[model samples]
Target chain A: MYKLYEFFASGNCYKLRLLLTQLNIPFQRIEVNILKGESRTPEFLLKNPNGRTPVLEIETGKFLAESNAILFYLSEGTDFLPTDSFEKAQVLQWLFFEQYSHEPYIATSRFWITTGKAEENREALNQKRAGGVAALKVMEQHLTEHQFFVGDRYTIADIALFAYTHVADEGGFDLSKFPAIQAWIKRVQAQPKHISITQQV
Target chain B: MYKLYEFFASGNCYKLRLLLTQLNIPFQRIEVNILKGESRTPEFLLKNPNGRTPVLEIETGKFLAESNAILFYLSEGTDFLPTDSFEKAQVLQWLFFEQYSHEPYIATSRFWITTGKAEENREALNQKRAGGVAALKVMEQHLTEHQFFVGDRYTIADIALFAYTHVADEGGFDLSKFPAIQAWIKRVQAQPKHISITQQV
Candidate 1:
């Protein structure tokens, strides 16, 4: 049976849980609270030296980390990942962009704010917000030209991006300025069997 | 023909060029100097709105960015990328770690230092160096146990991490402590048909 080691509030974990639900795949979710230092425990480190959550125990003793990697693993050979080579590569590009450009700014801000640590991280947040805005602008431009991130269809690319993007506002990002991204959010939400960011099952 | 728009100093660009050469995949490399703001030009923006180098034009007028994604595309069918589903996912995990954890810290420091911008960005470099060291510590821990990043085989995961890691000293990181990583670098370089990171062919 599949098992997921995750923190409920994490977008990285959410991305994996959301896809598993969308695909109607059954799995068990075990909470690994980062704030409490659960992920850094020696046992957890054995599973993932990186000490991050959303680790998928694909089978007994075999595990995978990195939410996008987990998403790709579960979605491959299914409609969620494209069969065409170029489209597949495009999906990967957006996943990398989400982690590097989008998440660092948007997700981290949300984490700091949600946990009441914003005051201590104000300067960092200000810098991150600027980056967050730039990332939103990039997404806005892309969504204006294409309905979806890759192949003009709802795939894991949209799933990977949708994780933190729909909730970027909680990170102090003003989404109203990004009309295209706003519309794309609605399109992704409209997909069949879609689950909310924090939902499980 | 495949055309790679890249900056010679960029580890991201080098990841693709290294893999293509290792796989005996013929491709054209066009240098885009980030120092002169060439990648930011209107013409280059048409290729990648993100304005980053190491964009792979897989075919005429069609492009893909994000270096790890490009590596995945070129190496999928070859031995560089594993055919097994689980092994492939493991490779993706490392690729994401390289970009998010390793590259930002290591590659950015190398850029600031190499460009003589470290003095102006002292605080940023110091912060980046700490992160770079932490990332190296993680890799050192991993390599201490496994010879390769995944399946105990040489794969694109090695190439992706090697791009920035082999030169991390340029970022003021002391690699003398990461004995395992130092050895892994030699293993990757010893691969058949392997090319130095900055080589064009």
Candidate 2:
């Protein structure tokens, strides 16, 4: 059985949980409350040196960090990952974009606002708003032409992007203007075995 | 032949250039001077909606963006990428860490300083310093245990990380303390057909 070290409300963690559930892979969920600095503990650091949530213990001693990488690992040879080389790379393209371009702004802003740090980090939040909007605009443009992020099918790419994007409103991003993204969100939710971010497996 | 749209100095662009050269694959390098906002132009935006350099034209009208994704695409069948499932995912784990945990701090600081925006972004620079140092510390700890990022061999993970880390000093990061990383830098440079960041094909 896989042991997932995660924070429940975290979109990064939710990416893994949603995928695992959809794939019908059973796993043990161990909540590491990032708000309490539990991830920074020395023992947890052994599992992941970066001290972040969503570490998947593939076995008792072996582990994998990075939400997208974990998704890639678990989805291999399954329908969630495409077999074509180009399509696989395309899936990775969006995954990287989510980590570098999308998650930092959209997810972090939501974290700050929801964790009650918005007032203290107002300037940083202001700086992040533009980036969040830009990411959404990119998604909106892509979603306008395609049904899913890759190959017109619901893949882990959709799961990866949808985790935070569905909750971007909590980050103070106005998704009302991005009708394409709004429509795509509904498409993602309609997938088989779909689960919300807050759902416990 | 692949056509790489790139800015010469960028670590992201260098990753692809280094891999293409090492793999003995011929490619056309189309310089997109991001410093002058060339990447954001209407023409370039058609190549990559993200408006970023290091977009790989795999063939006519088929483009792939994100440097690590390009590396994964090109290195797929080669020894540059491991064939084993677990090792492949480990390579991706480092790639994600590079983009998320490492690049934002290490690479962005280098960009701000090298592009003469450090003075204006001093507050931001100060903020980034801690993150850069922390990333290096993580590298130091990992490199101490492994010769390469995964499978005890050089892979795209090294290429992805080497792009920024070798020039981290330009970002005002002190590398003297990370002896393991310094040694690993030399190891990466010693790879067969290795090319410097400034070297044009």
Candidate that would win on DockQ: 2
DockQ of each: 0.90, 0.92
DockQ of candidate 1 relative to the true structure: 0.90
The candidate that achieves the highest lDDT relative to the unseen native structure: 2
Chain B TM, per prediction? 0.97, 0.98
lDDT of 2 at B136: 92
**In model 2, which runs have C-alpha deviations exceeding 4 angstroms?**
none
Which lDDT tens digits does candidate 2 get at residues B1-201? 899999998999999999999999999999999978999998998888888888999899999999999999999999999999989999999999999999999999999999999999999999998888988999999999999899999999999999999999999988899999999999999999999998868
Which residue window of length 10 is worst by lDDT in model 1 chain B? Answer: B192-201
Candidate 2 residue B27 Cα shift, in angstroms, is: 0.4
lDDT of 1 by residue, B1-201 (tens): 899999988888888888877777788899999999999999999999988988999789999999999999898888889999989998999999998989999999999999999999899888887778888989999899999998899999999999999999888988999999999999999989888865656
Candidate 2, residues A73-134, lDDT tens digits: the string is: 99999999999999999999999999988999999999999999999999999999888888
For candidate 2 chain B, which ten residues in a row score worst on lDDT? B45-54
